[model samples]
Target: MRKGADTMQRASDSRTKTIVVVTIGVLILLPAAYGFIEKLTLFILAVKRDLIAGFTIIPVVNYLIVTAGMACLLIWAVAHGMFRRIEQPKYTMLEREEEIDRLDASENRTGEDR
Candidate 1:
């Protein structure tokens, strides 16, 4: 009975944590997204009326294209699970380094014997 209660408590805690994180993210991201959208709308209107200079439009379009490309890349990475095992690469790198050190030590020992 105590174990079951503890499990329930843990589950509740996890849910609360997820809710808090999502709430905070929404609070932060929504405003920034709104601002960007507002600016984009104004920029589009300006371009439509040919109010913006050609040089200015070129840079703005380039920025939009790069932002879109990066957003797509981020989506692709998330879908491919690139962020799931964020620490796995560090361990793999350390393991490779250890293997290389061992091989070098063995080579040195053999050279000393010869």
Candidate 2:
């Protein structure tokens, strides 16, 4: 029975670690992958160049960097929204305040607030 309980605890710990690692990996990789795909699509279409109408092709190479940056920002925003919905992050200011209040109340109860 003790062995079984220990095994169960270890399994639960392993599962939790897996979930945290996967969530972090997805958050980091999703944005990068999406940005790459969008940029590749833009290049393949060749429409952006025509739309910008030779403004991108300047002495300073401005359009290339700007377009790529915009694509990255767009992808990051989209992926961030998706991840936030799925992960339901726990670090809100209200939650933090509640936690602090609980800690303070407990300390006061124990006469440790002096």
CA displacement after TM-score superposition, residue 49 of candidate 2 (Å): 6.2
Residue 108 in model 2: lDDT: 88
Candidate 2, RMSD to the unseen true structure: 9.5
Error of 1 at 57 (Å): 2.3
Q: Which stretches of candidate 2 lie over 4 Å from their true place?
A: 47-114
Tens digits of per-residue lDDT, candidate 1, 1-114, equal 999999999999989987998899899999999999999898788778785444588888899999999999999998999977689999999999999999999999999999
As a whole number from 0 to 100, the lDDT of residue 47 in candidate 2 is 49
Clashing pairs in 2: none
lDDT accuracy of residue 34 in candidate 2: 100
Candidate lDDT scores, in order, read 0.91, 0.76
The superposed Cα distance between candidate 2 and the true structure at residue 36, in angstroms, equals: 0.5
Write candidate 2's Cα lDDT for 7-92 as tens digits: 99999998998799999989999999999789757764664647664444463356667877997998998778754434345557
